[model samples]
Target: MTRAKRRWLPALLIPLALVLAVLTGSVQAGATVSLPPKTADEVLAMIARTQVRAFSGTLQQTAELGLPDIPSSTPGVTPGAGTALEFLAGSHTARVFVGDPTKARLQIMDAMAERDLIVNGKDAWFYNSADNSATHLQAPKPGAPTETLPSKPAMPTPEALANRFLAAVDAGTEVTVGEASSVAGRSAYRLSLAPKDPGTLVASVSIDVDSETGFPLGVHVQAKNQADPAYSLAFTDLSLTAPDPGLFQFTPPAGSTVTTKVLPARLTPVPDADSSPKAPSPHGTRVSGEGWGSIVMLPAAAVPAGLTSNPQISQVLQSVSGGRALTSSLVSVLILDDGRVLAGLVPLERLQSAAAAQ
Candidate 1:
């Protein structure tokens, strides 16, 4: 495959992956219940010492990012991208079973169809019932390096998202504990993180931590000027017990088209001796800011030409002064005519300014 084709999948998957990272689990608010009052530092410590791991649960994700409604399947557009856009605009439910770090399964329930991601040891399978297609990937040999799937998103658990945010707590962020609440029928302490910078599109982030186990039960990200959460993922039902091992085993249906790939032990780099030292290489990515206002810039060569030419993508992007932009409640993406793409959890103006500087 050409470099452009290879880069296209990851480029298009970025937005969807961001959305999916915050998408999962459904919240069930119950009567206000009081838990032991703990300081922010104490709660942070609790999260750091969490030991619960194996569990099975039902997750629901919802987004109200002000994105235009797009069909799951668009003519002439890549099928995966179209489907990802559809998920970005709507709510989805999935069953998640995590037995350990290497054994897990996510079954996304779609209307009359289901998409599954099963990871068993070093073997992983992604199957889409709507298309009856499956992709199997095997990890590189022991003691060797590993590779990532460009097209797949490692749908995060609420605990994982909470840890990510907690790890980034800094002087620019304010951490506080809100009222105790309920999530997935369990009592949880509400931990809120608010950015001190007004320039960020994010208003605040709220995490519901299980009162007993310290496991994060839900995550809600609010955007500035948006009353509803830009994205929410929480469990409506949860089980602490380990799931059946059978859930991790997956077999493709009969007659299904299966593509199998064994990841390379090490990725070999192509030498580019003629590349200019002053200019960013097409494969190189750079960040243009910090904290919540950060903008990720992809070099023009890194962007796939097909992404810009896709009719479906164009329909959602509006013509701005310097480029076409996909503006949502919490994030903004700018696709310059020069093919470089910039995205961040900031305003379109921030992206425009970054592009102009480039």
Candidate 2:
């Protein structure tokens, strides 16, 4: 547990297993995966046509985190942050950028930690300069959008988070085919899926299939059972045939200050904090009640105006690069690369009901 404390231990436990990938993405570790022998329904229908093609490479990732049940006042196990994913495959749109590229959600929550997400397509932007805030989420045109998807507690459809990050393979899942490995050099086949109800998932993956240009190179996921760790995104150096809508345009680096909000989070119910489990948190540790960073982030905009965004009110911000502490929750909100704003407190009925709902 040393990679910056396993990158803030999955942003304080994927805020309740961001749809529970804690260990639910499935890959069955009993080791018996070997395929090219076909049949299990033609290897699960060629692993359901693997996707995200139209490549333009550069996706480097590393993880060793698995907080099975942290609750000793959190913070301190090590092994964190080594994620550097980059994407650019087009034709429906995909131009996702993540952490360390001008503050790509640093401070440990890999894949854009302290906020800063701009997923094109159904349009999604989550910018939080520590609470000066910004949100503009639409996400719902393929079918099903009654709103309310804070991190998928019981909502699945957007084609199931776009086929669980592109590995497809559905029949209710249970594959396991491994034994052909190569990764970035192609020549792959390592099918894994194990959601016989491991709560819903804790592993799901598909990789390499060019026994002769059958397409599909790599893909992975691990969620649900907590420490079910395994997150991969790759394109190698692609060009199958797609990309160039001006590469999904997002222009905004000149004076960089644009705001919009709405997605999974966006609450407005307050009053409570300072409940005193000996109270502390924005890093002082010793916490109780709400989880995640446990609270802190202020340099002005001391979060209180009818304060919503809760599970227990944990959206500490204060960003825009002049002062820090861009914390998270409400399905992540760390935008200016969250680091520094922690002067903790979190009970007293959720801080007097979020300061009397601000």
Best by lDDT: 1
lDDT of 2 by residue, 1-358 (tens): 0011110222222222231111111112222333365433444455455453333333333332221212211121111111110111111112232211121111112222233344454454444333334445454434443344333221111112323333223334466665666544555555554434332223444444433354544444554444534444443433444544453344444444555433332222222342543343342322222322233332223232322232122323243333332221111222122222222212123322332232
Candidate topping TM-score: 1
lDDT of 1: 0.69
Query: How far is 91's C-alpha from truth in model 2 (Å)?
Result: 15
For each candidate in the order shown, give its overall lDDT on alpha carbons: 0.69, 0.32
Q: Each candidate's TM vs. the true structure? A: 0.82, 0.24
Give the distance in Å from residue 352's predicted Cα in candidate 2 to where it truly belongs. 23
Residue-wise C-alpha lDDT for candidate 1, range 1-358, written one tens digit per residue = 0111011111212434231232343444556788889998888778878888789999887878898776554321222333566656668898888887678788888777777778777677877787788878666656655544323334567886665555445667788999998888999999998978788788888989889998889888888998888777789999999999998999999988888766542222222223332234335665554456656677776554466776667778999876798988887888888788988778889889888887
Q: Every model's Cα RMSD, please?
A: 7.5, 18.3
Q: How well does model 2 score by local distance difference test?
A: 0.32
Q: Once superposed on the true structure, which residue ranges of model 1 sit more than 4 Å away at CA?
A: 1-25, 73-82, 140-153, 261-283, 304-306, 309-312
- Give one clash count per candidate, in the order shown: 3, 83
- Candidate 1 lDDT at 82 equals 37
